[model samples]
Target: MIDPRRLRVLRALAEHGTVTAAARALYMSPSAASQQLAALEAEAGHALLERRGRTVRLTATGAVLAGHAARIAAQLEQAEADLAACSAGLAGEVTIAAFATAITEVVAPALPALRARAPEVRVRVKDAEGPASHRLLADGEVDVAVAVEHPGPLGVGDEQVLLHEPLYAEPFDVVLPQGHRLRADARVDLGALRDDPWITPWPGNPVHDVMVRACEEAGFRPRVACLSDDFRAVCALVAAGTGVSLVPRSALRGGLLGSASGGVVVRSVGGRRPTRRVFTAVRRGSQSHPLLRLALDGLRAQAASLAG
Candidate 1:
């Protein structure tokens, strides 16, 4: 019979790409991981992994098995959660993935309160770009993920819409150093930036697409001056006069440079609004998990001011 534990070990090995890495992620010794995988292979009567120079990669069959393993692991985790809920306290670890602002504004503030009330529940965070963040959720790498839902679609799973508050209602702005030539105008016409240097994120990132679409709507292609996944770094580059960025006013709290701030300015296009609609997401089937529910409730309460 195929042992679930052995399948899990193989799944970890497949997901991590190396026995040593899988062992580290699973919190087991490399030898133990190898042993379990060996046993699983023996039970399955086939070669699940193929050897490379110093590592192993999943075979086609192994990849299929790993997908099943993920579903099983999720069900097992939910089962454990249900059992834990029957006890006196909420207890379990939940990994969360979120974009930059949510980590600082929403997650940081809400965690302390949530932890105090449910001391048994442990939370960890993985900083991710929006589209990437949702993929992490779909991959079973995290329990919850927070992201903005603007032109790019978010996950179709169960969601707790947090920005039900009015953080702001304005067009996204072009941020630059305090003394750029355009700062004088409250809104710069997009056509004027046809030849302007721009800083943006990696191609697949949510913000990168946002910039592209915004520029497209403005009837021009942005001349990308730099590539950075770090939102802070993107702003720093803008502050250093390296390039200009389209950022939400909220993010300006950290990225705007003084002299550069006066020089660089956010300008709204005639009718184009480059804005993000932020929300909290949980697996639709996972609402029964108390930790997920409570965290959403706390997020709602904290976001009351913004959602309004």
Candidate 2:
């Protein structure tokens, strides 16, 4: 019979390109990972890996086996959850991956309640950005992902593998340097700033897409001046007279009236404002697991508290 442990190593290799990376994820040395793969190939009686010039590529057969390994891993997780459910109150560990503000504003706040509900349920947090959180959830590296909602990447087909639970929608606030033409306005008109140079997140980020689409709907494309993913840095750039940009309301620590002292003014948009929705994603069938369910409910409660 093919060994399940070796299959896990193969699946890790498929998820992470390099054997070194796969070995690191598995917490094994490179030489030991290679030996496991060699043993698996012998069991399968086929060449599963092709090695050339310090790189490794899976053979077609290896890819097929890796796919099976992924399914088997999910099944094992389900089995573990089932067995844990038989024992006691929430008692298993749940690892969640999320970006900065979500951790500070949502996940961290939810923890005290989760601990009160189930002291034995451990929740581990990993720092990950937008797509990386989802990727980690898909690869079985994380049990839950606090991710921003986006199209194309997590489409209908992913429903079979993931269950997305939207937590909140945060509206974008326009951040302008002091003394700009529209700084003193009660609500900034997006169309009036058509000629202004804009700071934006790099292309492909969810926030960047929202900024571009909001500008396009306002009738012109924003002329790009700088790119940064960190909202703090974006605000800093605006303070230095770099350019104006749309920042999510949650990223700013204080309220709109309180955030104007740093040489940058934050104002609401006049027309239809663009917003990004944040959600928690988990494996499809795993949400009902006792520990995971409690964690999800705690997050929802915390999100409601924030919205209030």
Please report the candidate that would top lDDT against the real structure: 2
Q: Write down the lDDT of every candidate, Cα atoms only.
A: 0.70, 0.84
For every model shown, the clashing-pair count is: 16, 0
Ten residues in sequence with the least summed lDDT for candidate 2: 253-262
lDDT of 1 by residue, 1-308 (tens): 88988876876676556899778767789999989988888988888889888878889988787777766666666686687678776877888787777777677778899989989888899998766666566545787877766564453221321112222232466775667777677777766777789998888776688788888888889999899876667777787788777876556554434344444555554456677666666554465678887877777666554432
Candidate 1 global TM-score: 0.72
Query: Can you write out model 2's per-residue Cα lDDT over 10-111, one digit (the tens) per residue?
Result: 987887788998888788999999999999999999999999999999999998888777767667667877876787666778999998778888899899
lDDT of 2 at 245: 94
For candidate 1, the clash count comes to 16
**Residue 106, candidate 2: C-alpha displacement in angstroms:** 0.8
Rate residue 174 of model 1 by lDDT. 74
Candidate 2: segments with Cα more than 4 A from true spot: 135-141, 150-163, 253-262, 306-308
Candidate 2 displacement at residue 196 in angstroms: 1.5
